[model samples]
Each structure stands twice: as C-alpha cells, then as structure tokens.
Target: MILTGSRLEVMHFVGEKVEGYMKEFLKPVETYWQPADLLPDPTQENFLEEVKLLRESARELSYDYMAVLIGDTITEEALPTYESWLMEVEGVNQADYDQGWSKWVRAWTAEENRHGDLLNKFLYLSGRVNMRAMEQSTQYLISDGFDIGTGRDPYRNFVYTSFQELATNISHRRTATLAKQAGCPQLSKICGVIASDEMRHAKAYSAFIREVFAVDPSEMMLAFEDMMRKKIVMPAHFLRETGTKIGETFSHFSDAAQRLGVYTTIDYIEIMESLLNEWQIETVTDLNDAGQRARDYLVALPARLRRIADRTRIPTLEYPFSWIA
Candidate 1:
C-alpha cells in the first residue's frame, strides 16, 4: 500500500497494529517485575539484614560505576519530558482514548517508569548515592528538557527511540556485567531486567519503522538518514547538577561510562550497524533519488563512524560528582 508521503497516515497505519506490538513487547503489569520485587521489602522481617547485605555489595562498586548509574537513573527519571514530547507528535492524539499511538506511548511510559524507580531505590538503599543531590539533578533534567532533533515527526521520533533504546540496552547490559564482576548480584539482576525491557522496547520501535518502510519507503529512508546526519542526542544531554550548567554533569557522566566500557563510541557505531541490518537498509526498494542517497549515506555511516571512534580517547580524569557522596 503506497502512502501519500503523509507521515500522519503512515503513523496511523502502523499504530493500528500497536495492540499486537504491545502484546509482544510489553508484559502484563500484573505479572511484570516491579521495583519492590527486586528491592528489600520494608515489611520483611529480614529487611535490615537484606539492607546490610545490599550496602555491603554496593561498597565494591567503583566510583565511575556509581557515577554512571546515577546518570542513568537521572535520565530515566526524565520520562515525563520524553512522554510529553512523544504525545505531541503529529499522529498521536492523547484526547482520543482509542488512538493506538497514544495507547502505545502511555503503555511504554508505564513500563519505563519502573526503571528509574528501581534504580533510585537501589541507590538509596546501597548508601552510595547522595539522594538529595541526585534528586536535584533529576528535577533539573526534567525542567531543563531536551531537543533531540526529531521535532514532531513520527518517522524521526521512532528512529530516535529505536536508536536510544538500543543504546540504553547496551549500557544497562554492560552495567549488569560490571555489577556481577563487582560481587553485586542484586544490582546486576536489576540492570539485567532493565536491559531486557530496553531491548524489547527497541524491537517494538524498530518494528514500527519497518512497517513504515513498507508503506513509505522513501520517506522512512529519508527520515533515517536525517536523524543520523543530525546525530541522535541522548535525553541525558540536558542533565545538570545544582551548581552546574545544563549538560555539564553529563560530560563527566559520559566520560565515566566510556572509561568503564559501559557505553562507548564503539557501542554507538554498533547500534547504527544493528539498525541498518534490522531495517535492511542496503536492500530496501521503492526509494526515490533522495531516498536512495539517504540509504547510501546510512549504509556507509557505521564504517565512517568507527574510523573516528578508533581515534577518540576517553578522558582519564574523574570529575567529582555531587551525586556521589
């Protein structure tokens, strides 16, 4: 089915299948894991003992790890900004209860809400985070907001989410591995579950783009190219501390992540390569001249990025984060 190059129409076409996407990607809330499930229960008889154990394990975590975790938590806490932005996308009408796009956004938000909650609670119990400082940063991030360069375009929005979700998945997965290596199994489990959610969400967003490519190949290809050309800015790009300017904290946080190998330039290149493969950019048909050029640019982006990444060096200096006491 050829679309009129209307992104709204393409969104509606794909939104119609959101119910199936939700079923496949998002789990029923009743059965899904909650923050309390992974955390020490205040009502439990052994709560104090569990807390002690948690703190003990947390002590083994490196300073860089703590900084990265705090940054990740702050980013997740800015969900309100993300949801508000997505709800305003051209095809999503929050007033329409039956709008599939709106439903997907709400459901996705609900699932994502657990990530920050779980991480915040864990950090608090671990006695490693400066709760007040972290809370302030979270508030600043939400209030500061962000411009991810997607504007209100659904095609660009989905492409951004697809890339962002995969990036989060890599960071979380690596954090989990590092957690286990630090002898913090609880934190590892927490990061592992969150990573799983990210991967699932990534698949859903990628599927949306896949369906779009089917009906609006040229437009979808162009959108993909445009986002890559502008570069995908992470939500945490707006993160800040109490005395710091916007994005100041994020620079240090990013360096910590890079140093720890939790998330790096290599991961970014790999994500681009994965998306190119996932959408079969090289083989996509029905593209106009512009779309063909976009596809050519995208197909070559990973290699180009990797050569630059090879020369990039992670900062060896560690900035003293207010979030870490």
Candidate 2:
C-alpha cells in the first residue's frame, strides 16, 4: 500500500487490525480483574477487620512513597482527557464506530479506567490520604488537561503513548516492590496488577508504531524524531493542587518520585533506547533525507541524554503534599 504521507491513510491502514490488537493486548471485561477484587468488600462480615488490616499495612509506607502513589493515581484519574485527545486524532472518529481507531480508543480507555479506580479506592481506605485534597487534585488535573506535543497526529500520539506506558509500567513496578518491602503486601499486589496492565498497553502502542514504520517508514521516522526532540511530556505534567499554580504540584510530586527511585531521568533515556531497539530504527530503510536525519538523531539521543542525566541531581528535601494527611 502506497501511502501519500497522509496520516489518515496510515492510521486507516493500521486501524483495520485493531480487533487483532485488542485480542492480543487487552483482556475481556468479564474476565479482567476489577478494583473490588483486591479491596475490602463492604458486605462481608469481616469487612471491618479487613479495613483495619489495610490501614495497618498502609501505616508502614513511607511519606514519599505515599506521595508518589497519590500522584500516579491522580494521573490515571485524568482518563477523560486522554480519551478525548485520542478521539480527536486524524483518523479516529467517535461517531464512526466502524472505523476501528475509535473502537480502539474506547476499549483502551475502558481498560485504563480500572487503574485509577483501584488506586483511588486503595488510597481512600488506607487512612493515609487526605481524600478531599486528592479528589481536588484529580479534578484540577482533568480540567487543566495537557498538551503532550502530539497535536492530533496518530504517529506522534502512538510514540507518546508507547513511551508513557513504559514509564508508567516502570514506576508502578517499582512501587510494587517498595510496597512489599514496607510489608504492605496488599498494596504491592495492587501496584503489580496495574503495572502488568501498563506493560500490555505499552506493547500495543509500540506495535502500532511498528506497523506504521513498515508502511510509511519515512513519515513515521520523522514523527518519532519530532516527538523525541520535543520530549515526550507526561499526561500529568500539568498537575496542580487546589490553590497552587499550574504544574506547581507536579514538580514536588516528581521530586518525591525521584527520591524514591520510582521513576527517574535514567528511566526516560532507557525507554527511548528500548523504543529505538524495538522499532529497529537503525536499520529502517527507504527513508528520504529528512527522515534519515530524524532517524540519526533518535539513534544517537540515548547516549547524549545519559551524559546530561549523570550531571543532574535530585533534591533530597521532601516537600509537603496537600494530598497526604
């Protein structure tokens, strides 16, 4: 199929395989795990006892860990923003359900919805969170939204999602390990399951990019390069507390994450390296001059980023977050 560098053409070509992607990457709703499965059930006779035990385990978690978890939960809670953004991509038409991109968006959103649900409920029951403040932050994040530099292009959007999902997987996996070390086995399990979902989602987006590269190598390569040059910003980059300025809270939240080694600069560079490897950017052929230049820049970015990361330092000071009690 000769694509005329039309993003719509590429997206349409790839959208045809959405069903197969869903089958391979997403779990059926009925069989998939729900937040209720991991949380204390209200109707059970032992509900109060379970709640007590949950709180006791939560007490073992560190302040920084709690802050990072709360930030992650808020990011997940802004699902509406993400869904709406993807729906607006060039080839995705929410009204045209027959065109598979919209279906993929809805299905992907459905799977992602559980992440926030599970984390929010756990934080509320944990007795360590200021629920009202956390709720306020979530509201703010959704309202503020974010501009991740994709600008309605499917290729750039897929690249952003691919990177974001991998980053989320890393942070959640690290949190799971930390939770277990803190003796909070239940929380560890929650983070672990969420991390598993993220990894699957990452692979799905990465696959989409790989498919695009096969058919429209030059344009896809250029898109990948543009996003990397702009830097893939997180969905929660605009996160702010109730009275704080836009993005003020996120800096503190990020510092807490760095202090805990949940997600760091090194992880960002490694994700880039992994994507270059996964997409086999080095050996991609049939690229025009600009595309080849883009490929070269992307290929060399990881080593350059590593040098900057080595010189950078994370602040040791802890900032008090409004979300924590």
Candidate 3:
C-alpha cells in the first residue's frame, strides 16, 4: 500500500512507458483520416447509401480515434495522478508492488480506442471536412492538446471522464446539427446514433463515481468539489486547438446539448446528489471541521441549483437550464 520513495520512481517509469505506448498506438491509425469537409453531402437522400458505405469504410478510423482519446487523456491527465496514487493505495510497498496499475491502464486504453476509429472512418469515408481551414483546424487542435485536472489521481480521473463523456456526446450531437444544417441527413443520423453511445459511456462513469461515493463519502465530496472548481475542457482540442474561445466553444455545445434533450441541469444535479446521498457524505459519523464545511456546501447545492435554474429560466421557459439570466 503505502508507496515509499522508491516505489514512486517505479510508478513514474510506468507512467512514461504507458505514454510511449499510447504514442505508438496512435501512429498507423491517424494517417487514414482526412479533415472534415471532404466527406459527401448528406442533403442527398441518396446519402444514406453513402453512410451505409461508410459504416464499413470508417470502422477502423473510428476505433483508432477512441483509442487515441483514451491514451491521450490517460497519459496527459491520469498517469501522473496514478503515479501519485502509488502513494495513496493502502498496503503495497510500491517498489515491491507488482505492476497491477499497468493492467488497469491497459484495459482502460483498450476500451478507449473504439470511439475514434468509429468516428474517423465515418468522417473520412463520407468526405466531410476535406476543406483547407478545417484540415488546419484539426492539426492545430490536436497539437495544442486538452486536459482535465492535475495530480488528483483516480478521483480526478473519474471526474474528467464524467464530464468528458457528456462533452463528447454534445460534440457528436452538434456535429449532427452541423450536418443537418448543411443538408446532410445521413450524417445527421449517424452523428445522432453515435452521440447516444457517448451518452452511455458518460453515464457509466457517472455511475461508477456514485458507487465510489458509497464507499468513501468524504473523499468523494472532496473529489466532487475539486472537479467542479477545476477547469473541464473539450478533448477535441487534443486534435484541434482553436484557442481562448474554447470557453465559448463549450458554452455553445452546452446550449446545443440542452436544446437536443441530451443531458440537462437536473441530470447534472441528480448525478451529484445521487453520489452524495449514497455515501451519506453529509452525515458522516466523524465530522472534522473541513469535512463539516464540505457537508454544509453539499446541503446548499440544491439551492444553488435553484438559483441557477432561476437565472437560466429553465423553469420559466419550461426548458431545462435554458434560462441563464
């Protein structure tokens, strides 16, 4: 459990190795992907046939993108925290500890590769962004990179993915919107379907955190607060770095998500409250002063949500979180 100094060194090395493996994994797959514009127009109802064609053509690229996403996030965001977690785990001396964490890392990576390949193959075979500026955007974003949190470890890891899954869902949904707006019915349908898959992934992580809360209430709350306070950005920047407007970019996506009936304000609150109540974090038997403060904050979260709802006009407009005053 407790990682001595020497064990920490091993973790750092493992982290480095994992990062290298991620880079290696990304190489062959990304090559086939073209920028967004070159894809076929969905305006033609005949485009459905094209989409069907892509279902076969784009599968590998879609899989690879998902792989890269998982690897990049883990390497850039989660690995350092795990390195810290070598210290957090309860019993094993890290130096003597077998490479158990790496196994978790690999499994996680395997699950991630699926999304990218699915999306990329679809985009390329469809000939979506073959244009110049769009192609440049892709390069710029990936080079700039995006991240979720700092040395927060598995806790931060959970938080990052919780938000990420939703964020990615929104992106997929918006891509659908763009396709629809561009008269591409086929692309819209494909994106809508893919977005649903993303929503499921996000929900899985959210549920996992809820389970985590049941076991370690205080730690969960601390992690929750940390997640909220820290910046949560879109991972697309990993492939397409635009710049300061990212905050605006996320806002636009959030607005789209609300309009689409994907995730709503209540969804966010429900996820948070479910974890809090399941853990009975607010009612912990041993309440240190800091923990007590956190509990107070947790108790007030609903009222905070109420104010946000009021400001956003979610209730007034009969729309969810739509009334940001």
Clashes of each: 0, 0, 46
Q: Please provide, for model 3 over 176-206, each residue's C-alpha lDDT reduced to its tens digit, 9 standing for 90 to 100.
A: 6655665556556656765675575566556
Candidate 2 lDDT, 214-273, residue by residue in tens: 899999999999999999888999999888999999999999999999999999999999
lDDT of 1 by residue, 1-325 (tens): 7797577777878888999999999999999899999999999899999999999999999999999999999899899999999999999999998888899999999999999999999999999888999999999999888999999999999999999999999999999999999999999999999999999999999999999999999989999999999999888998899998999889899999999999999888889999999999999999999999999999998989988988998999999999887
What is the lDDT of every predicted structure here? 0.94, 0.94, 0.48
- TM-scores for candidates 1 onward, in order: 0.99, 0.99, 0.52
- Candidate 3 local Cα displacement, residue 170, angstroms: 7.7
Candidate 1 worst ten-residue window by lDDT: 4-13
Clashes of 2: 0
Q: How much is 219 displaced in model 2, in angstroms?
A: 0.7
Candidate 2 residue pairs in clash (backbone atoms < 3 Å): none
* lDDT of the structure predicted as candidate 2: 0.94
C-alpha lDDT (0 to 100) for residue 139 of candidate 3: 45
